[model samples]
Target: MMEKKLALVGNPNIGKTSLFNQLTGLNQKVANFSGVTIERKSGTFSAGNQMYDLVDLPGTYSLIPKSKDEEIVARQILEESQRPDAVLVVCDASNPERNLLLFSQVADLKIPVLVALNMVDVAEERGILLDTQSLEKWLGCPVVAINARTGKGLNELKAAIEKAKIPDLQIFNPQAVFSDNSTAEIHDFAHWLSLQSGQEYQHTESETAKTDIKSLQQARETVYRYKKIKEGMAAHHIVQSRERGNEFSFDRWALHPVWGYLLMLGILIVVFEAIFKFSALPMDWIELAFGHGIALLEQALPDGILKRLLLEGILAGIQGIVIFIPQIAVLFFLIGLMEESGYMSRVMVLTDMLMKKMGLSGKAVIPLVSGVACAVPAIMSTRSMAGSRERLIAIFVTPLMSCSARLPVFTLLIGMLVPARAAFGPLSLQGLSLFGLYLTGLLGAIATAMVLNRLMPEKGRSTFVIELPPYQYPLWKNIWISVYQKSMSFVLEAGKVILAISILLWFLAGFGPGEQMETAYNQSLETSLASGMQRAEAEQIALSRRLESSYAGLAGKWVEPVLKPLGFDWKIGVALLTSFAAREVFVGTMSVLYASGSEGETEMLKTRMLQARNPDSGSPVFTGPVVLSLLVFYIFAMQCMSTLAVSYRETQSWKWPLLQLFYMSGLAYALSAMVFQLSS
Candidate 1:
């Protein structure tokens, strides 16, 4: 049997997503909508003898869209090719007037829709008691009150869906939808809408033809719909007490001008510390497991290119990325907790003023905060911003924020530069460094936006509108699912890039043009023995010398002149070149290079980096200035190709992405050179 298709529709923050998660569990997959970057979430579940396919559409306030994301919701509902078999309108019981506005609009479309009145418990706690039977009678449809967080009424919702029929309701006539003087476009749209509702479209002429007739009609229509809705809901949804809840008390401080910013900063510090402290043990275990696996493979397999490829190329590179999964998962878990608990919305509200000062729309806060996970989705999220210039600015500056892909490289470098025992009071130096780097990225983004604001012509700005959800305990299952999905996404995406680059790097480092590698090995061995070095030490020296003469080394050497002033050697230069594919690939590339250069050594990448010596002066290669310079470089550089591609897609032009790449890379280089030169 064909599965019945249902779409979950509602305004933002109505527990619609929570209800979807409860229904789908871990069966859902996230993809892009047909021709847009907006995320599409869909899944399937069995309902007794029947199966159902559910899609969660983007949240919007009304059918008339103000942005691309909202446009998708409107199109999906009204277009014949994409309309769902039924729509489950998730409404907030506490805010019936606002939510019912959307519900009434959906009802007028004459499509089958069932009301999933969500957050009933919270509503009752606020002294708002909703009469489901009365609501059902008014709408001529079934209404099921559900608490999505606790799985209450889930079975009933599924049952209601299984038996749902076309709602015998049309709140308004399509023929009378438009004003007599409406434009041709408005008439055509209404005509199209009427066709879907099986209603006739009528045309009328008037002496005055307003160019903005659609907006005028929509405003009038909204008032009309709400008036009818209020009359229907007057007695059914009762508020027994007008008392303020704890939400008000909390918001007093959480949205305060002073305390709110401090509280938010303190929470961020704690989150960063937790990411470092909590992930240490798991990261160590992962490293140890990979180390042992590599060691076993080294001992069991004969010395050959295949063994080297398996151990040095594949295992080493993968370990570089896999060991960071715990940190990535922790980051996502803490972020998910903030979002699920409603604090994220508060953060957006708090930062709106500052964002405006930076010449960014208030909506840009979502993409900026989300950039911490990955810039691709963050760039894609700029579609929600109303103004074209604001959207472009958001897309351009978002990549400056340090994403999870940079986390591995940052952690690895920080561990080498700042000792684990170093601390400032209760905070570890490494954690502080991590937070400082993130702060730097944010500041860089702001600074760039300020400059862009001055350079670009003024486009009209949209007012910042946001709904603050009441504070609640996070749902652990949802947090866990989000963490798993995000961590796996990082692993799968980074793993592929690392594996391909590792193999290519290994092959290039293991071979050289003509007899250059053989001559370098022979000459290095002879000189080392002549200096009275032990045979084992001499052999290691020979291998290192051979690596320096290989094809990858030649390329690294070619770039060394340009990078020399930044305190980077040829090997570091090579890693820099490969990591353009992804920021995290810096770690994997270094891992592959070090493993190929160091024979008969089983030390971890960190140990090898710490012990590394400059070939010319024999001093530590990763000196204080060099490490600082490198960190500064990665912090500012547009190093990921995927981010560039996403930026192009979001802006629909190569000029923006290309300019972003050159600007970021140039800034990274100039800043790194100054840091190294001044520090040295």
Candidate 2:
């Protein structure tokens, strides 16, 4: 059955998306149609026997088309063919006057509407008593009070909607209803608003124009008076209470430039520690489980090229990429949680001062923080940033943040080099090393931004402006859905790339130039037989030998000489090159490569990496320099394929991505070379 469509709309930062998520649950897809980059969030929910399509619109202050985004949003509202069945306006209960002004504007469209008085609990806590009934009567629409975080009043909101029938509203087009000459006095507001509306106004120099401006001033005053009447005085008192009542003032400490930065540092330290400590167990389990499954696939398939492709290449690549899904999901979830709560605003407020030095709008913090998950979405978040220079700068520098995709490489290398033993205090030396890796990556991003700011100076004066949203607990369902979607995309998209590469890699290392692979396979078969071992172990040994003699290994060996000075064996060299497309591939490549190289250990892959040796030196290969070099390379390199593609698309040119590739590769090379030279 075709579902009725409803849309949730609101000013930016008011919990509208959260409410949409709560209604739709996990049945949602975020995508863009046509030109705009705003997330076109559409989902289906079954309220009764009927299904409904709920679209969560981009949050904006008004339905006025300004930039590409504002234009898209405004056009959607005005289009007669695609008008929603009903529109639900989400408003901050504590900030009703501003919200009501917009609400009245939407109500003028003559569509059946619902006013969601969000943050009502926060409003009440500040001694603001919201008369929802009065609000409903004032707007002639259903007024629902909801705390999207706690799931409060959701059922009532839903029931209200179910009972919803379209009502006729008086269309009040402000432009049509009011026109006067005194536009000179409020010229700034008019110009700012006209830009949003995409309208051009003609001004003339005359006393009559002054009279006209004064008349328009009177029109605006009339609108204000009507707005107040539409919103009861009692409700005004409630909202005013909220603005003045909160005792938890941050002006003293957390807002201080010095103290704010310190607190931010401490918060980041905790975040880094939590990501490493919590995700380790799940990651290990994924690695182990996939390892066993791949082994089984080898045994079940025939001893030929197809089996090798299926077992080695596809499986290897998938396992290489999918293992990091948990970490990526965790990172996105945590960031989303921080954003849903009001704390994100405070960070932006504090950082705008420093961001100015970097030629970024304070709003650039959104993209930068989001860069932790992946650069593509992070770069897209710059839409909220007002100025072109700030957005461009954000796009340029966001790639340097170590994304979740790099976590696997860092973990793999850290485990390979730094012993898991505890260091001075309770901290594991490995954990501290991981923390250092994060710092290195962050420093690289900051340095890159600093340099870029100096070189490509902004043409216009760009200032940082960010809204401080009220604090609330993260809705778990909303967070889970967000985490799940991003994690799934990483698996489905990167998984395909890794799977193909892994299989090809497996084939190369699985089968060799000729007899060496066959001969090794035969000897393993004979040894397993001589020892009377099971068919499975015998098969494993054969597969291992075939890989040792395969093209991938030969490729690794041929390149080993070139990489030896870079503190990498041919195996490490091949892994490094392949890992350019994906850092997660490092772990997968090592697993497959080690499986090809090793003779005996059929146990855990992690143990194999720990015990791995350099063929020439006959000593453990993963020394501090080797690991440090590899980690440093990943820290600066733009390794994610998706990120490169995004950079190309955003800039509408390949120049940026190509430059990114050259500079990152050069930086990785020089830094790794240094680490190797100093340590060796």
Candidate 3:
């Protein structure tokens, strides 16, 4: 049997994607539309004996194309290439009047349509009722009320889809809608449609015949639909109740001028604290497991290059990948909760006024908040913004928002510099320090947005209109899925890069040219023998000397002079150079370098880092000042290659990403130098 295709369409924040997720579950995958970065989410589902392919189109308020994402939706609706067999229009039950405008347009296209009236539960809670049977009869189509979050009425909605059919009567006349418009483009489009549909067109010659004909027609249609819908509701006796009187009362405090900001700040502090305190146990377990695995490998394999590579290169890289899973998982879980409960939309509303001063639309808040998870998707989210200039600014500043990838680096450094005890009346000093780092990044992002707003040329004025979705209980299933998918993506995507670099670094640190390594080993052996050193001690000294003369050592020495002012040694210089590929690779690089030099120590990477010393001075390398300096550097540096590539792709130009790289790196260097100098 042939598979049927269906297109899912709705206005923004109407629960279209949630319904799609319910239908497709784990069978869905995301792809890009042709010649655009806009995402195309397609999936397959089986109903009875028949299979269906569903495409979740980007949400839009109307058929008008104003942005890249909206353009994709409009093109898919108008173009005939690979058109769906049917279209499912999702609408909010509480405000069906506002949402029916798109449905009216879709019905005019003369396609088979099925209406899924979603959020019925929310509508009922808000003391609103919809007469579904009367509405379905009035529209001459099936209307099934559904709650996408809890899978309520989903089966009935699917059954309606199975029986949906195209109606013979068209609700709105396309020719009449555009015949009297002054815009040449609209007139031309109307004439073409009339010719195709075999209808007559009535053209107007007056240019001032109310040039806003489109808006006027939309207003007329909206009034007409609402009037008909209200009559149907009255005939069916759908009444409003007073059970949920306080449903919208909470908005008074949430949207307040003063209390809103304080509430947001307190919420952020709690999120950061949860991330640090909850992930500690799991992170420790992962560290312990990897350390034991390395020890087991050492005991099983014979002493050779292969054994060294397995223990130091492969295991160390894996350790870097696994140790951060807990942090990444927790970050996404909290973000998902905020989104599912509708708190994120409130945040957008709260920041809208302040964001306008920075020349960004309130809609840019979604991408900026999402950047805390990962910058790639966050940058993509900006495509929904209505203006090009705002989108570009949002993309450019998002990377500074302290993503989950930075969590590992920040936690490592904070663990070294700050103690685990409470300070300032029962607050964890370490947790507060972490919170400060996150705040610093957020402030930097806002400051950068302001600067870019002034620098970038303006294309058009952007508006910030958004629907504040009502708060609801978050679904545990969705939260778990989000956390799992995001955490796995980080490990798989970054793990590949880390593993390859770790092997290369191991090779460089293990081998050297000519007899330099042999000469150093011989000199160290002679000195150890003259000092009456034991055989084990002498072997360790010789090994250290050999590592110092290896290729990695020479490369480190080459950059040592440049990094000396920042309190970094040759070994740190090497790690810094390798970390350009990714920020997390710094931990893996240090692990491999230190493990390769240590003969048979079973210490974890953190312990080894604490005990490390400068070969010449024999003083601790990771002093408080040095750790803080490194932390400052990572906080500001554009060290991730993947983020740079994504920025270039989104902007379609090298200038922005390259400028970002240099500006961030320069800032990192200057700040790190200052911190090192002041602290020392």
Best by TM-score: 1
Query: Candidate 2 — worst ten consecutive residues by lDDT sum?
Result: 186-195
Best by lDDT: 1
By lDDT, the candidates rank as: 1, 3, 2
Per-residue CA lDDT of candidate 3, range 228-267, in tens? 5456556655444424435456678777889977888788
Candidate 1 lDDT at 453 equals 79
- What are the per-model C-alpha RMSD values against the true structure? 5.3, 6.4, 5.6
Off by over 4 Å in 3: 119-125, 168-171, 174-246, 294-315, 362-386, 403-422, 428-434, 514-544, 587-628, 676-680
Off by over 4 Å in 1: 173-178, 183-212, 235-244, 299-304, 366-388, 403-438, 526-531, 582-628, 645-653, 676-680
Worst 10 residues of 1 by lDDT: 195-204
Candidate 1, residues 1-680, lDDT tens digits: the string is 98888888999876787888899999998777888767788989877878888999988787766566677777787778888888999999888888988887788777788999998888888877777787787787788889999999988988888556556545664345555643344434334333333111122344246334545566667787777777766755543444455755688888888999999889876876676689889987987888788888889999988998898678867875686677777877887898888888888887787888777756787688667767765676576576677788898899999987798789888988888775768788898898899999989999999899788876344456677888878888889987887777666655566666667767777789999999999998999999999887678668767877898778888999999999999989878887876787677567656653332232377788888887678999988899999999999999987677667766678999999999999999999999999999
As for candidate 1, its clashing pairs are none
What RMSD does model 1 have? Answer: 5.3
Q: What would the per-residue lDDT of candidate 2 be over residues 1-680, giving only the tens digit for each residue?
A: 77888877888877887888888877898877456555588898876577888888778766545345555555665567667888878998877766776666566555677878897987787777677765666566788899877779988887787655433334343453345443334433223243345332223446354544433543464466355545554543433344455534654566776887898778766765566667878987887888788778778877987776776566656666766766676667777777766667777887787888888756778788777767755776676666656677788778888887787678767776777899989889987887788778778878877888888744545644456665566677867887777676656555565566555555555656657888878888898888998886577657655655677667777888877767888777767756756776666567656663331233356676657876667898777788777788888877766667666766677988788888777887888888889988
Clashing pairs in 3: none
Give the poorly placed runs of model 2, Cα more than 4 Å off.
46-50, 66-69, 119-122, 145-243, 247-253, 256-259, 295-303, 366-388, 403-423, 427-433, 507-569, 587-628, 646-653, 674-680
